[model samples]
Target: MTTAYYVHVTIDQGKNVMLLDSGCTQSAFPLKEFQKLLFQFGTQKISHQFIIADIDNAILLRLDFFENHHCLLDFQNAQLKIRDSAVRCCDSQGNLLKVNVQVRQDTVLPPRTERFSMARLSTKWVQGTACIEPADTVPGVLVATTVQDPDKQQVHLRLMNYTDREIRIPAGKIVAMCLAANLTRPAPTESASHGQLPEHLKTLVEESCQGFSPEEKPKVQALITEHQNAFSSSQYDFSKTNVIKHGIPLVPGAKPLKQRPYRHGTAQEAEIEKQGQSLIREGHGA
Candidate 1:
């Protein structure tokens, strides 16, 4: 079954009417309506702003005072009201320009239910002469689970991490991960041939590698190796060194190398050559 409702809107000034579907977020009427209303009522503008709320009971938008306008909405016998002061408008455009509108609804939500499931195991033994009877199944550990009730119309979320690790994901990081997973097209197979990293990861790596030195490449490599070994051995503890607190740096000299023009030679060797040339040019050494 479809889950939506329609709202009928009317502008009392021009006697104009409109039908708004459930999906409609905003609505507006022609300017002439406000001009006619103001002329007839002899009022500069209508007071009381209006708010539009969705079926889920979320405020969508608010319309301020209506200038050169009369009543903004006639809810077709619905019990909606505008509690705020009226919107204002300048004298320009004959005060009849189209005025934007929003729909507000008042409703209550129902309660949700929870459910649970289990996994089981069984065991049996056999002797050389006779087979032993099967043992009764034993119950495993119990886990809590919650899901949105189909009958309930609301946003719900459930998170389960078996390891019991405390992972605090930053809002920006979560957004980046979501975008990365939803790329429209597959990345090129020969990305390395182009000598460029993916835009997003490249940005992350660049930001991470900034201010690193050629001499520090070994240190960065060691850090990465340490993390890899610790993780592989199941000895890594995020609570001890969180990414936000102890960030991972990129390959050594990556930042400075990126800032300078691409050199055909090895990056590490090129950096050394550039430094040597600068020193020689400055009459410091050969």
Candidate 2:
């Protein structure tokens, strides 16, 4: 079991403890008395909705609160900081834009966990105007495609931790970017913009002697049609690939030696077994 950490806080003049959870979206106190829990927050003049929880601690602090208030937690030095918000936007072509996303609070993700957590989105577009897709920029993390709420600027990021160790995502780190798709498509570049889908696809093979087999051409076309949004103009970016494997090389030697297999823990063994069964089901394994 993982250990828990607590911080001393005062609620309604009563000294109490609150669990600091980075993975939590909202912070709540157990008791009914909901006075302003004073602490070092930012200058945004923020107000949080109070909710009730049955936990022993006076408050169950979450990540969103810190992000909204622009508060930074320095775990190494035991320091809490409040800073003015700094949002970023790198490129914007027509209605297609890329905006920065930051974790609002300090949190540690356990291994093999997946959840949609709210984070600070740095964009000026109003709701319903844009859709969110993964930018495939961050490494060692998985970002799922999520649409921005049309009525609000809020964005919930689907984060998945693939490693077996805890991942410490500190506040203000550019963990991911939202690929915003809004009205008014970006101006097309290259042959795809001017011609119809079939014509543009023909251009790819117009000059080549090679041709797709009649039996397989339809299937290939269907796959592209299903994800047409991913292929705009000619610059194609489908998304990131997620797979874990390592290749071992043998050295040239006069003597031969046999080696034992590497061992994995219970969790890893179960996962390997599951994947092996999957490969077999997919006819990749006998």
Candidate 3:
């Protein structure tokens, strides 16, 4: 897919969408698209294809290459067909309705700061839709797959800018096929699940106020429900942000020792990431 407008990025592009930029052209990939393509076909690697500027194209379908390779392109109708019988799966992809994610505010995603925002889409839906993973679609940014609001049709996106410079996303620009797929109805909120208190909250209340009188149970439950966010789920959670931090102090002029990063394979990496993410998600860590 190719975006209509050109983007200028500061840092080197990510691994998935590598580009070999020269002249006025560059090759880009994965995309601002729902349907993505990753090929790297053909055992022959050209002397070119370096890590280059990421533009709006996933496939660089140059006219000269088709002419040189004796392959024909239907330029008039704008279609390409491979006659090889081995290539069977290409034709199986059916029609798709690409959804456009529009921003409410002109978002400026700074490289070092985390950005989280809500924006509505063109199509209104009763359920959440997953983001298409904006790879090189909008240059250095990637919009995370998140649940959308059913009523407002609002989408929560965690915008990450891998580039050095800030990426300015205007209020009404659509990056090519920036698409989304509708997901199943999101899980009910706390009030929707039960009457008021969720199962966990009820359990917490029962466990904490077991010794309280029957007359005070309702009041206690109400108090706990109102302050539920301050409640910790486990030993690891310490998220009462207003509370003054208390930690053991070191003597004056004591230099903190540098700790080596924990090394584990992909499994540990994923777990560590999840741990860090959960902190941010729950508003425990900034």
Highest TM-score: which candidate? 2
lDDT of 2 by residue, 40-114 (tens): 222223356556667763466678667776666544222345465421212212121345677677756788787
Candidate 3 lDDT tens digits, 164-203? 6988988865532223344445465576455477566777
Candidate 1 wrongly placed segments (more than 4 Å) = 1-28, 31-33, 36-286
lDDT of each: 0.29, 0.55, 0.49
Name the top lDDT candidate: 2
Q: Which sequence of candidate numbers ranks them by lDDT, best first?
A: 2, 3, 1
- Angstrom error of the Cα, residue 197, model 3: value is 18
Query: Model 2: residues >4 Å from true position, as ranges?
Result: 1-96, 127-129, 134-139, 182-286
- Global lDDT of model 1: 0.29
**At residue 71, what lDDT does model 1 achieve?**
32
Q: Each prediction's TM-score against the native?
A: 0.16, 0.32, 0.31
Error of 1 at 30 (Å): 2.5
Q: Which ten residues in a row have the lowest lDDT in candidate 1?
A: 173-182
